[model samples]
Target: MRPSTDHPVDEPGWGPLARYVIAATLARTSDGGAVVAIVLMVNTSGGSGWLAGALGACITAPHLLGPFVARSLDTARDSRTVIAAASLAHGTTLAAAVLLYPHTHPAVTAVLLTISGLFGPLLTGGISSRLPAIAGPSQRRQRRAQGWDVATYGISGTVGPTLVAAVSAWASPATAALTLAAGCYIAAAVIRFLPYAPAPGKTADVPRPLRTLTGILASGPLRRTLYLTVTVAFSVAALPVTAVSSTHTLGVSAAAAGILTAAYGLGNLAGSAGVMIRPSHTEADRLTTHLAATVAATLLLITLTPSFPLAVTAYAAAGIANAYFFAATLAARNEYAPDNARGQIFVWVGALKITAGSAGTAAAGALISTSAALPLLLAVALTIASTLLSLAERRHNRRYNAPCGPASPHTQPENGRPHPTGPTDRIHDCSNRG
Candidate 1:
């Protein structure tokens, strides 16, 4: 390993954040593929649905505690240390999973999965927080980097499972391919040694970062962001449930499922492209409108026809809309939130994501077994909730912006709009001032 540098991370262009994004993408890809193989291997061995669900939860449940682990990123005086330490710790978790899972009992498997999952949020928060430090003074460049990051995530997302599936088909036990994935995590860590900055001076009391995060999440605007994201994330959870269907019951190969998953990712690319291709708008009205439309489109996902062609098509469209929704919510939060709370605000989004995944996964698992359509209906209801909150905010803004009338809480001034000064006659004697 290279000697760590104390270089300032923030710069004018792509640097460590860019590298971190790619490394994170590779790790996620390998884990996802390995998980699918593990799940299938267990099922083929005659594990019951309960066992399958347990294993699935094992894979995801540790996310419930992600918020706590993620908050540790806030404690770091140097993000580089956090990044390096957390990345290697994460790599170790994967290694344990790969080496230990095959020979372990199912109960032990669940324990191993939980232990492994603890690393996920830490890595997620560290990388996310580290990125802003890497790209300086320009939202455009940072957004583009994020887009590339997400795209790589999608690409690996598409290819990883298929690779595992292929190897397993040839090798008799796909689950063992996790050994390869474990190695990939180590590779991710090595890549970070290339170059990255140490984090800035202490911004908050290290001991209380998690508590501070809770307060930030309580803000009305942040609440709205999380609520909307939670709903959207749940809607996305349907995609996985549907893909699993294609893999298991519909006679679709794992490769086909992987491809179908990519289609949704492609849709996400379309959604993200909207921000890049179009003239950007910084206004709240435009942002809310885009978010509302995106959520509305999400409701249509449940309505996709059962056919593989149509289902994949619906999923892709959902991804496009959903991506726009996420970007708008995030941009609006960071743009409008209290400057000091910005880090906390962003951190909570990661927490909400993990929370959403946990809830959505368990719910979807139950519903998918009964009726694949069930998860879709639940998502539609969630979309309605997300949209309603968005529209409510719109109405609130309208009320807040309207000219102060008799019933308005804001007092009208001589200028005929609400002002800090009361509606008094001539506060400043302009006539004689000159």
Candidate 2:
């Protein structure tokens, strides 16, 4: 389907979209800040570095359960209630962890943080899955809203750690944790005011996990998009380690890593802003492949540059490509995911990316002592491989005459349901192609 060219004046859902962006940004900031706050809290409390690391892991590991948790959102009679409850639970657990750290065993604190992490996806993928409804069925508006959503990630990444650091420096790490928890509570309250409703009859027959998995596997575009997203996430997750090592090689203090990382985050915000101002007109699948190649090229440039300034520029450029790539991936999911399984697809893909990122971080930590350039090289190779895989899949589909685009006007909607004869239903028709 062609991208919507509807003017802003024609899109009257800005109020709800604004509320969503605000709530999502707050929740995301809490999620990102909590990690730093927890680590600092543990270290400043005379805990071992290993204990701090373990506590941080407790906050991240349960993100793998995102898909199952998101399934509840998909089938819920009212997703807002589920989302609000999850946010409250996440905040309560984080607060508990902070308050009990001095009085409880490290294992006990870890368990509390793990419970907090279990609801983390509701702040991310769960919020994202609702954008379609909130954006009110205009593809252009939805795309713009998505760009705003991407911007929140960039904003939170920069703001969250900085906020934690400032708070920890001024007051204490425990105070920082409490501040982030309060943000979560505010996000939950904002969610309560969002103008959203579940699609009628969409959840009447809850889909089995196996059925959702089958649907994901059957949709070629969705599968390819998820593959690209995971590969890119895995590659990008090594950036922090690589940046630190690269700065050391350039005879800079390890603290220079922060400057380089911040540059990338700023670049990400720029890219997202560009998308919001002018949503891409290109097909999402094609845009995703192009962006992936751009990312690989930028990473390769980083490896070739010996000058620190040039390296920083390369990192920023790579971030721009990554942002655009992520936006395209979101568009692909919107286009190819079955309506009944949309929430699950978003959450499942998010969970897989988190798992891949953890593995990538571990691999980079293991290999960075060998050479600063090694991790970046690995990233370049993985991104290129993912792009090639997507191209190969597209070629095979073409050879088999299995087009992944929207169904033809003459084609009938599945199950004899009366499909809307409008561009809004284009995604539904594309899913039927599977």
Candidate 3:
């Protein structure tokens, strides 16, 4: 089940990509806002803090189902229909949860929120999985699209929580929840107009979920990307805790923590914009490794900095590296994923990152009381480890005379012919490279 190599007569231009960014941004904004909105809603409604935590669990735990949900989308006859329906379901269920939380049983509210969470991947990875097709077979276009896709995430991360906080402060948490739900609904409406073609004919030998998982593990490029992604996610998740701790250590006002965090977020946005203007020509796998090293270095700088301003500068530098790292991750997915397993690859990787990030956050919380610098140092170590892992794999591939390109032997068909799924014509033996 290869992606169709034939180009459409009316090859989509930036129009479709713009719409995709809009839809993705809206969906992601709602997702980010939901956390703050739920906490505020529960707190204002006289619920215990633990109840809010329980409902947050309901939202997050269903992310484990992402791979299965993605499999359903991958096999659907009309992916657009499936995705749009999922979007609608996400919005409706969330709206219902917000409305019912005050009056209904806690169990009932949890059920509704869980249902919304079940469809969460459709808003994130499901949307991302379509980018390669939307950008056509042109690698340059795909790279540019990846940059914009990353930008949408950065924008949503900044806008969502701020939106929720403002609305909750001025109006009410219930109103904020409804507003977030409306954003989801709007995203669904926008998604329907995108240039998504109907799914191609099903292949007789479509890989099962387990087989797809095996393929992901066996493919060196993908395996390396996922490893690095999870490590980076874990490290980044500690930043918020680290920011607050650093402020306390520096004897600055706690409010300055927001300033430090905003520096990173702004740097991310700047980096994303730079990628959009000048997309990298380097191979995705190689770029990912380089960016990981850069992140490790920048994080190390943060740990070494004694002054708050210097720490903020280091954080911003790390954020820039992270932005490029994330863009490289998307490029790797677009370049290496099998057509039939693409959705699952994206969703499963996302699920893994979410799990790692949660663990990192919990770990940071537990360790922050001891040393403010501990989590940042841990992040630096983890990123360096991930970078070394990638470098070791590349070294192994070279020693074995194997290239990590799409046409690598690992991706060969059972008939012993290379079945390259991505642009690999330019790829050559690893030994021939610098």
lDDT of 3: 0.80
Candidate 1 per-residue lDDT, tens place, 1-434, comes to 46447564345444455566566666666545556666666676677877766775675567556656654455455445555565565556555654565577777767766776665555454355544445453566555544554555455566667676777777744444454456455645655553544332355644344665555444434455667777777767777776766554445676677666677788887777765555244443245455655665655653555566776787787777766666666554444334343444555676677678667866888888877567877787777777776667656644453443432232233112112222211111222110
lDDT of each: 0.57, 0.79, 0.80
Which candidate number would show the highest TM-score if scored against the true structure? Answer: 3
Task: Please give, for residues 105-129, the per-residue lDDT of candidate 3 as tens digits.
Answer: 9999999999998888778888888
Q: How do all models score by TM-score?
A: 0.75, 0.90, 0.91
Taking every candidate in turn, the Cα RMSD to the unseen true structure, in Å, is 8.4, 5.4, 4.9
TM-score of decoy 2: 0.90
Give each model's clash number. Answer: 1, 0, 0
Greater-lDDT candidate between 1 and 2:
2
